[model samples]
Target: MKLIVGNKNYSSWSLRAWLALSLTGTSFEEELLPLDTPEFYERIKLLSPAGRVPVLIDGDLAVWDTLAIIEYLAERFPDAGLWPADPHARAHARSICAEFHSGFPDLRGQFPMNLRREPAPHPKGATADRDTARVREIWTTCRSRAGDGGPFLFGAFSAADCFYAPVVTRFLTYCLDMSETERAYAEAVMAHPLMQAWCADAAKETAVVDADEV
Candidate 1:
């Protein structure tokens, strides 16, 4: 499999797809594109239907969207347990992932992910405040459901956590305040081996996305 992603310094969608694939323990080649360039458009147009990053190519098949890529990988590697084992828990995971996929515009617009940067003040007014509150609410609710299995949103790492991984970076990058539970969850995600690897790679990259820079 070959996964085409944007620079590790930015591109939240790329982070989601990359993390999901990394957790699967499957070997795949990675192609990094410097975002916001004509070359990016040319490369993505040739690789993905939507002209986006994080396109996963498995033999002759190409999956573009982050959610679609994860679903395909989950089905292909069932032993990875990309989703929860229980049907009910799996349903809950999917619901939250969908909500995250479509919603949280305020928070997203206010705080883009920049992994190597220190947090700085970027006032986003009432909308972002409310969105931040919603993020806390979601984290609290998920943490409450987390049993002794692991520190992830669900007991074990799943597609839901993969979907929200960028939000974790957003919170950290923006230095937004979160509750103790939320902080702990964020810490767990950051501490994951794959996440650490991603961060290390991000630190080594020289490419910059001006819009996402802090």
Candidate 2:
């Protein structure tokens, strides 16, 4: 299996799929394409019609979109524990992942993921403030429901964590105000071995996407 991604510091979707694939404990090749470059376009055009990063290539099949790639990985590695085992918990996880996939435009637009950027709080507009509040609510609710399962959203490091992993980085990167529970969850995500590895790579990246430097 192979996973194609974008610049680690700026590509939140790429981070999501990368984390999911890495957790499977499967040996896979990684290809990083610098975003917004002609080379990225040239190479990605040959890989997927979506012309996006985080495309998973498994033999003859290629899965585009982060959520789709995650689903593929879960099915491909059943024992990886990508989703919560309980049916109800699994559905809740999927619901939030879907919300994350389709929602949060203001927060996303205002606070693009930039791991290399120094941590500082950015002034939030009304929309962004509302979005951030929603994020905090989601995290608090998830953790409350977790009931000592573990530090992650679902008690274990599942796809829901992967979906929100980038958001965790965003919250910490912007120094957004978070409650104790939210802060704890964010810390646990940052402490994950794979997340640390990804951040180390991000710190070493020389490529700069000016648009994402918010």
Candidate 3:
């Protein structure tokens, strides 16, 4: 399998797909395209019609969107435990992932994922504030449901973790307020080996996206 991703310093969606793929314990080749560049546009066009990063290619099949890539990986590698085994837990996980996929515009627009940014509080808006509170609520709810299973959202580092991993980075990068529970969950995601590896690689990149630099 070959995965095409964008600049690690700013591509949150790419991180989602990459993390899920990594959890599969599958050998795959990765290609990083510097975002917001002519090269990225030219190269990504051939990979997917969406012209987005995080395209996973397995054999002759190409999965474009982040959620689609994750679903494909989960189906292909059932033993990876990408999603929860319990039907109820799996549905809950998918619900949050879908919410994250289509919602949270305020938080996302105000705080773009930038691993290279120094940790500090950035100014926020009302809707962004509400978004943060909603995220905390989601975390608290997940913890209550899966507290005994493990430290992760659904416990055992499933697709739910991958979906919110970038939000964890956003919280830390912008020094957003987090409760003890939320902080602990964020810490657990950051402490994962794959996430650490991704961060290390992100730190080594020299490319810059001017829009996300703020």
Candidate 4:
């Protein structure tokens, strides 16, 4: 299996799939493309049907989209426990992952993930504020329901945690105001072994996207 992703420092979607793969302990080759570059477009055009990062190639099959990639990984490696074993927990995990994939466009656009950037206050805007509130609510609900297993949303760092890892990065980067529970969750995510590895790799990457540098 092989996973193609964008620059580690800037591609949030790519981070999701990458984290999922890592959590599964799946051995796979990685290819990183610099987003928005001519070379990147050319490479992705031939590599992925959607011309996007986080594309997974397993033998003859190619899967695009972060959620799809994660699903494929889970199905291929059932022992990974990518989703919860309990049916209800699995359903809830899928719902949250789907929500992360499709919802919160305003927060995504306004507070793009840039791991290498220093923390700063969020800019003022009703849309950003509303999105922030929604994110906080989601985090709070997930953690509250997670029981005492740990600080992860699902208590064991499943797909939902992988999906939201980048959002955690965004929150840290922009220094978004978060409740005590949200802050603890963020800290747990940042301190996860896989997350630590990802951050270390990202810190070493030299590719800089100017727009995300702020």
lDDT by residue (tens digit), candidate 1, 1-214: 9999998988889999998998899899999988999989988898877998889999999998888999999999999999999898888888888888888888887788888887776777798898888878878888898788899988898888888888998888788898889999999999988889998999998877888763
| Ten contiguous residues minimizing lDDT sum, candidate 2 | 115-124
Q: Which stretches of candidate 4 lie over 4 Å from their true place?
A: none
Model 4: per-residue Cα lDDT at residue 81: 84
lDDT of 2 by residue, 20-116 (tens): 9999999999999999999999999999999999899999999999989999999989999999999999999999999989999999999999998
Better of 1 and 2 by TM-score: 2
Clashing pairs in 3: none
Query: Where does model 1 exceed 4 Å of error?
Result: none
Residue pair clashes in candidate 1: none
Question: TM-score per candidate, in order?
Answer: 0.96, 0.99, 0.98, 0.96
Write model 3 residue lDDT over 125-170, tens digit each, in one string.
Answer: 9989999999999998999889678999998999999989999999
**What C-alpha lDDT does candidate 2 achieve relative to the native structure?**
0.94
* Candidate 2: Cα lDDT at 200: 98
